[model samples]
Target: MVVQNATENSIKIMKNLKLKIRKTILIVFVSFFSIFSTYAQFDGVFSHYMHNLSLVNPSYAGENNMIQASLFQRTQWIGMPGAPIMSVLSVDTPFKLLERQHGVGVQFLSDIFGVFNNQQVKLLYAYKYKLGKGHFSFATNIGMINVICNADSINISKLTTDDGYHSDNDPAIPIGKQTGVGFDLGFGLNYVSDTYSLGASLTHVNSPIISIGDKNEFNVLPLMQVNGAYRFPLDRDNGKYKINTNVLFLTDFAVWTSHLSSILEINEKYWAGVGYRYQDSFSIQFGLELFDGFRLGYNFDIPSNRLILNTFGSHEVFATYEFSLVRQKSNSTKSIRIL
Candidate 1:
């Protein structure tokens, strides 16, 4: 009889503990939703922001003076369910017309998180003019943004009823896959020289709105970004070693984030760096030039926020290639009069 009473008490205690845990989890979820709903969704975060300048700043198109192509992929919050995954592809080239320099490019992006997926395609153009020892560029991009919500993938059976929530009975919740498309626009200004660069941009200038269904809609808000970088020779005699430092800032007026990084380059062929994103994560990067005009890079991020408790980290990889399309003059003759 005593053993039976003890067993009953033990079971009651376990049940009470589980109930408390569920309540705690529910509170955390509610708090997270309340905070998230106040902010607008922005572009996917990239650890290799230096190489992805063209994605955020249209003025970065063709800054390399060669036809360039790049590809990137990132997976965030490893071990965390429904974390973000992103991919990007872009190409740009420079041209001279009417004695003026111009640039043109195209970019494609895909981002997925939770039950939502987003795809984007943009056409970029830039006009450049000499400013001091550098060139100043004004640029713009127009694009289509498509968003998809996979409501059908949600498991209603797994949802707990302890909170008195019912997915099937909720009118506000979507029951099937929903998709929406909207127009996006952006503008940027940049200044670039051999040793340094600076840029600022605004994306989603139109604040586009898209309706997924009669019950759901999405509104994209404007985001502002600024970045700068400087490079100097560490081995001045041979100029084979150098240090590059970069900073990037992003804001949607209500929220802001920043990143600072420095890289050591050897023989212009190898690089390693470390970076910190404010209140977010710390990253390590390494890269090598695989061949002439071709390079590859990788980055690993260690979270510093609450996400660290749930995830191991994030991973990113990228590749870039650059080559000139213009033909070079092989030989030149000088007249004696000119000499």
Candidate 2:
């Protein structure tokens, strides 16, 4: 009788645990859908946001004192139909004029999901001034955002018609491909030191409006972000090993999210890390410095909610290169013929 009771108690505990999990997943999905339904245009989230700081903050351009270029790509919600795919290419360089430091950069982004495509190009400029222990940068960006919708590809039959509405005759739905373009603006401030950094930025400051069709339009909402990072040396003598912690917070005034990450660096050549996105996913990340001035990284996200049932996960990869324009002087003089 005791053995039978023990088995019964085990089964009951398992059932209760499953019930709790279901309730949590339902709450997450409802919250996500409610927030997304209210926004027409939203920025894509990146798991490797630490390396793509310039994408959100213009002041990050040229902060490294070297010419830098990067490419990044992400595929979200694997195995799910019409999942989001995004890519970005960006370059930045520092220059001096009239004994004052300045930065300039350009970025291109392409994002696609479902039947819609978004492309953007932006030019960034930043002015830097010396502060207490680090430099402060003030920056701005101007860009053009273009959106295209393949309205013909949308299946009208799949849409619900329960409100005494005919999907085929709805004038709000475009009968063909529709495109719209709008001007975008952003501003940022950043402070960086040898061991730490902090930044804040605002995207879509102008709240650009793009009209896709006669009745359909997109109202771009402004997003605010605050980010910071700190470094701790594990080996003080040689500084061969270290730990870096990063955090980012984002909001549109209605919905908010946060990301936290910590990474361990080995000999400045390789690193591994883990990250968490609040109410979303946990991620594993690793990377290496392939060669001088070049690095590559990858991140994989595991869903923390019901998305795990429908999708495998998300994947991201990024590559970056940095180099200085000034040539290094040779230690010894060389013959003209050898040169």
Candidate 3:
């Protein structure tokens, strides 16, 4: 017995070492790729992506067969000047016309990063096809984005000589607010089944060019996203408690990032979860349901990178409400399959 235990321990140590080595290699490779291939400017990042699925993927609109409205807000890098702040509002509904399932939605987003701000309005359309017990959905998006830059607000006097902030007298710097407008397009596909959901989307498919200040043009590249989630019930009888495992992968024609999380929900009322963003941060999430259809959620992020030195953390909040206008023939026996 003593000999067998020693052999098992050795094997465990070897496995752990191999895992660590693989993780280290992966991090190095991703960092290298990010430094070399990245070109598109950073977009607004969100923590509660699971709750705001339709914001990223149009196909998720009206997937629950109900009228739904949601709101999301995020403040990144607490206590840091010129950090990113963003908010979005969206509403979607399903309608059947001529024996076909169709959905329509609208979204408005306001994002501010440093002296740059972008406001966008989008209209979404989706068609759903039923296949056995599941559904396949295709969606398209049409939108316009207004980009504004406040060049005059930049303060250069506070900068140190070593910090390289000496653009105060530059002739190219616009003296006032510079604005530009661009058209945006996107497409998405989503599949939903009894136990799992999967989706993929591409945004800014045309690489819209927005000229901010004079002679300065920015290209908004296509952003790719792939996400999946699976539900596991603790008890088969009532399903009062269940676990949801989710993963989201994203690329902006530059670098890649991912978020992985596991959440526990009880009686469809309360939920808690923990998640890790690849080479980014760890997050704690909490949520509650109220009054049948209203939901509130919050998330806190603890950065693992160099930003942790003087920053406290990031915060995000979201709310959603869902309601059905008319009852279906099998409403009593149907289950909620929304993301």
What does candidate 3's lDDT look like per residue over 201-251, in tens digits?
Answer: 998899888876566666787999898989889999999989988888989
Q: How far is candidate 1 from the true structure (C-alpha RMSD, Å)?
A: 6.0
Note the Cα lDDT for every prediction shown: 0.79, 0.79, 0.78
Clashing pairs in 1: none
Model 3 off-target regions past 4 Å?
Answer: 1-40, 155-169, 327-338
A best-first ranking of the candidates according to their lDDT comes to 2, 1, 3
User: Compared with the true structure, what per-residue lDDT tens digits does model 2 show for residues 1-339?
Assistant: 999999999999996776565555434433332333244445887888787588778988877677889999999999986677999999998899999999999999988866667889999999999999888999999999998777666454344233233445666555678888999999999988778889999998999987877777757889998989888789899989988898889887778889999988887779899999999899999999798778899999999999999999999999988777787473222110000
Off by over 4 Å in 2: 1-40, 155-165, 329-339
Each candidate's root-mean-square deviation in Å?
A: 6.0, 10.6, 14.7
How far is 84's C-alpha from truth in model 2 (Å)? 0.6
Clashing pairs in 2: none
User: Could you tell me the TM-score of candidate 1?
Assistant: 0.86
Q: By TM-score, highest first, what's the ranking?
A: 1, 2, 3
- How does model 2 score by TM-score? 0.83
Among the numbered candidates, top TM-score falls to: 1
Predicted structure 2: lDDT: 0.79
Residue-by-residue lDDT tens digits, candidate 1, 197-276:
88999999998887665676757778899999888899889978888898889987768899899998887779999999
